[model samples]
Target: MVIIIFHFFLIYSAAAVGLAPPSTYLDGCQPMSCKRGAPSVRFPFQLKGRQNESCGSPGFNLSCNNKNQTVLELPKSVKLLVKRIDYVKQMIQVYAEDGCVQRQLPNLTLSSSPFEFMSDYYSFDSTYKNFSLFKCAGEGWSHYGSYYTIGCLSREPGSYVKYTSSDYPNTDLFHCSRTMDLREVPEGLISDESNNLYFNWSRPECGDCEARHQGCRRNDTKPSGFECFVIPIKHMGTRTKLMISGISIGSFFLALSLSVVLYMHHLHKKEKDAQGKIEQFLEDYKALKPSRYSYADIKRITFDFKEKLGQGGYGTVFKGTLSNDVSVAVKLLNNFKGNGEEFINEVSSMGRIHHVNVTRLVGFCADGYHRALVYEYLPNESLEKFIFGDKGENHFLGWEKLHEIALGIAKGIEYLHQGCEQRILHFDIKPHNILLDQHFNPKISDFGLAKLCSKEQSAVSMTAARGTMGYIAPEVLSRNFGNVSYKSDVYSFGMMLLEMVGGRKNIDVKVEHMSQVYFPEWVYNRLDKGEALGMSIENEEHDKIAKKLTIVGLWCIQWYPVDRPSMKSVVQMLEGEVEHLTVPPNPFASKEEMRAKLPINRELPTISE
Candidate 1:
């Protein structure tokens, strides 16, 4: 029995070692669509006949219908044809097969599935618009302007379903009876004419993989989890697989003992090669300006990380003191498995930045897997503490100081945009990233999400949205708004500026009334109506400062990047008096209305000197 077990182990090892590599196993699961012009299916979405079950996440299976359309069947047997898939945004657009989305909307249920309606995924207060659906029997319903008739659902002649923005429509006037209520529908999803419905998924998050142009697969350790890896370019053909299988079977016993030894040696060589590559990169990077430190040096400078200042998604920051009595903040990067893009971005961008308003990179540590960044410590901490903290007078930096800080931040951003050899766009520009010195001077910090492009380049290509959700620009989330550029940073700055004025987050669910849920829109309405801002104002001067900042922020957050002002112009607007500034067009209007009003041929404003 012992001899037989040993022989079986040898045979298994030989067969495994001689078979084709794992890359060929995925060849059958490559991206495919039901028909031409249909959305291609890959990870997180698999076609039943075309791809293996392991290729897609649970509850994400798609199938081809009789008409060769990609069909997504919901829990209630409701089927919709897939129109498009935005892997970067994790969104899928679908429509009914019969060109009537409303007919299927009543039966569409996203529960028990990995997907959610787009409105539910965003959870923005503005996206919540409840409408009442009424079944009416009348030919004169067209005269009622407030209600919209569902033309497709009205196929039964006299009786048809009509929907209105009001919660309770005058049923008697139209001889109608309220049938159902559609709650929390987004404006984009309200119109039936488009016949398209949008959905978003959050499970088995593969957006990061898609953004990096990598392939994602289920982890062997778990059934539902996923891991990203480099995709091999070539796949073994059927003939190659057949030949390899034949050879393995023919020489199984002859090569059995040697296979195990060779496999162990191969594993050792791969690890050594990876280490060698990292060492080579570090050696070449020594020529850069920032001094490279070892892990031991990092421990000494940080005193074994005795005092942790803050922690974020990327890393943890500790307070440290240099040998020369210079106080510094040392950031120990997280155990990231990426290609060191974040570390390279921070060092390359901040090393070239010399402005007083931008943070200076003192040095960095890259010993094996451990990485750390050292910077001059700001005693006052971040601007977020002062603005969003208690309402005490001492904590409030006052309107004048706040204005000065805003100008300083603008100058720093302008320096990043135009002062450097290559234009640097800070993808994250919230109040939390704005550090304050002992004198309360604002300095922009954190370059992990920064991107560099030529100053002459009008736009920068981005695969995924970066920065905090509330501060991210519309275009970053969806390219339909416009190409991403320095204007993206301006939009984030605008959100932060508005937060400064509102003394709270831009999206505050704890507000007293629903009107104030979206603070920016509320601010716009007040300014448009020429009403007082209602914030605790001391006098006339303070009111003007508040109004000026509000208007400027509104201008910075225009829907299209082309409509936003440059950082240089923003700095001038901040330096000038409030009286000289004019209120920009309302940016909170509906998307369709705003697009129709704005010119299609409008050129992006040139960066002012």
Candidate 2:
């Protein structure tokens, strides 16, 4: 009767605390398991507590086998061997036999649930300890892996122990920019056999339990959990509450302190890198600033080039005012150069040449690789703005503008070749490259790819080609196509002229549609049949100019560089009134009637959209 009354009293005490009956618990924790000797297994987790149905949350559930090895049923076809568990920190160490078979992957979902990952965006952790190692005789040397450390409450500098491979994409399964990262390794665990060694994992800080509580003692025999001390009834006083508050404050500050240290370390590295970049930028363009302007003036003139006009692949251009509000385009490079080659090149070319259709160079900024070239700012934008592609808006330049612009471009190219001491090849010539001034007169821009060669040299052997596709000379594709020469610029300019005439791109070609309409080939086909393109642009004078431009375009893109006329002759033709344009034979057509059409493999990279 006394025993029964004691049990009922214990039940009442538990009820007052909102504690459910032990029978309702998922942990069927035997009295022996509940003993202080047994390692701790907390709520939402247990040591195989279910009789037949089994323990814990549906997703986090796992069971211990007969010999005390934790067994996790990740899936019907998948199982991971749980190596160890840290109850105070809440983590489980498991070894997967092989990577999930992709199709039969385990579902470790926590979304809309209490458990969730730290990051919404999938990325490797910078704080987590990462390593790549090779097994002596293992399948592959230097096997790659990563692990993250987390801290619920702080204790010491090395107290946190990280968890990894807990969820999909968190481990090896991941994607980047709409593309999957496919791991390439044969089925089975990575093994190094020569030294007869296993993949050694870094030991976690979880060997000891959490710090500070009611008189806790370290349990060496159990080794993974704790032993609680009985709190004296008298000590649970006003002073006890204050003491507890102080400990909580200390713990909170400890975690905050660790974060502060990490952040400070990152800031230090950032400052160092910034200094290095500035120094390098100054060194690379060393010759430029001293020869042109003082450091004090550079700061004043640029507002430091801070008033940016635009940015391009070569560099960023800023608007600057100097000496009585004279507008200038200050070009600052995005990347640092090895030496002053690029600076010297820009200054040398712009300094020597003077033409009505060229943007004049005024000053330079070669202070380190922070190179910037100053030029006169044109009120009008690039030709790419006026015509090219399916232009929907109607600020129509019409035939008059196109004719004047084409003639101006021809003269610009002519000057680049003949006006300079040596022939200068404008490797890149496109609609976007054609700049306009206040008068809307076209002037060739972007001489970064310009190269100087003696006129006597019939063919210049180029190391590698640099130019835009659709405008890139055929010789760049293969030597058999043509010889790389100043005429290559003429070919690119010709394509630009045709695009202007049609008010859209003449090349309707694609990587997959290489066999379709090549601009030169398609134009030749149309002209040979004596048919107009039936485009939207119309006027008799415009039609006449379009026909002449097309014929000139065909002449410029001739198979052999030797066959193409000089830019001087091209200017005369574009500026001429009489119509005596000669038609050329088709070169881009089939070399033979029976041979298969071929796609050439060459070095090419896509520009960012």
Candidate 3:
């Protein structure tokens, strides 16, 4: 019986190893050279529709546009022409088709995409200067000769400020609708076409394999499924040699053995270090307020991971029911980089949080490497489905309900900032993270990117950028904006509020013209011009609510962190009379210019009935 069990284990291991498909399967995806002097396309970026899904993962698919030009689609529905793909550097140079890359700049958010803009690669041209395009509606400032006219605004009488030398336009003086960072600004100075942008990806599947003279193929044996397999020497090159000039095969084997021994020792030390961290976490775990469940309890509660609720970059969420008929959301964490920091973060933050606006943590499982968090089940799901989509019953939530939801969210954020023993800053605050209960009341969920600081700490230090791109504060993006503080969460909240008011994304791609693209900037222009809010108002109350939300949102989204209001102030503004509210200084106003428009004495302008 012992021999049979050993043989069964060996057979299972052998089958697992054999499950990895051959690199030959990827031979179909061999480098393809473009006819237009474009870079050779290779693994990770496969031609969509032409290549099988197995050839590339999500966000790695490429396609040819209507003009037969290769284009790469990014997060937030952004598409750029593929000018060059450098396998050697693992970077891609993209160009905007119309040369006005600035129009697409606001949409180049990568939080949802697998790619990132290359930080190291900037415009190498010394003569290049950053130019901005503002889509404004007002008198044509022909005297400001530097300002190029793009087109006329359809919603109002203003012409789009086609191009400008500054990002912060004199919005007080110029009724600018929207502004976006223009890529390849020098090109705009010369020609009206051909703008270049560079993007890089950190997905290791293809790049790492390529570096080792091997090819990557998708198989089910690994978690990510993509595996690196050895390529034949002949495929590497005819002139390539594997051996050192002075070393014999036997000597190489002996040296390899020694290296392996050293590597094993290093791994052993790493294991010990990991174990120490785990033991420390366990020691600290006893003090936490939340209930800790064993791995078996987690599996049993989740019914062997039967029903998956959803999945994201962090991990997959499963629907679970306790023995007492209470439903819960169980998030099984995966692809954690180190030491279970995310697990600790959620448990630590949510465990202490006890508010109606914030989601409650019912229990947690941190057995060995298996980490999961259980939260109260939210029946209505995320605010995104209701706010953005045309799904059944989602859009029927009246403007009043939307107002309540926004207020609940503001209260939740205010609680996070002040209610806790330590102030928790939720870096990622968007519609998707805002969960709605059965009554449509909002509860802020997902604290994966949350940072806890002492109540006395005015600013928090961040080594890398956190939060979603579209909602991320300008300060968090760069220190030049301002110090990272509780105000960062305020910026994200403002963006979310604007989305709720607009019933669309802030950086919408489907808008009729570039002038109407960024919803917030467009609304600001109308408000500054004393024009109607230009929304689909059902009645006077709906119009008032929409306008109120818009004004409050604009106040929250001030360009500088200091300019923005605190969550406490935001909640007050939402609950207070709309008549008492005032229009904020134009966020896009330039530093050189004085106040462009005088502050309005009356209430915020309402949408025309």
Best by TM-score: 1
Task: Flag regions of model 1 displaced more than 4 Å.
Answer: 1-288, 390-394, 602-609
Q: How does each model score on lDDT?
A: 0.82, 0.58, 0.75
lDDT of 2 by residue, 1-609 (tens): 344444544554444333222222222332113233434453334445642233233444456556555555543434455554444444544554343222222232222222222211222121222222111211221223643222221123433222233222444322211211212211222221121111111122222323332323333456533344433333355665665556555544554565566667878999999999999988855522323755455567778657877876677777877877878777776665435555666777776667888777777765654667777788777888888534367555877777888889899889888887887777889988888998889888777777777766545667777788888887867776556777788888877877776666766654255633566676677888988855554677767877887888888876556557888888888877637777766656666621233334322222210
Tell me the lDDT of model 3 at 297: 97
**True-vs-predicted CA distance for residue 9, candidate 1, Å:** 99
Residue-level lDDT of model 1, residues 479-531, one tens digit each, is: 77877888999999999999999888999998899999999999999999999
TM-score of 2: 0.47
Which residue pairs come into collision in candidate 3? 102-182, 137-158, 138-158, 172-596, 173-596
Clashes of each: 0, 18, 5
Q: Can you write out model 3's per-residue Cα lDDT over 328-373, one digit (the tens) per residue? A: 9999889465568778889889999989999989899988888889
What's the candidate order when arranged by decreasing TM-score? Answer: 1, 3, 2
- Minimal lDDT window, size 10, model 1: 119-128
Query: After superposing candidate 2, which stretches have Cα over 4 Å from the reference?
Result: 1-291, 294-296, 337-341, 389-391, 509-517, 592-609
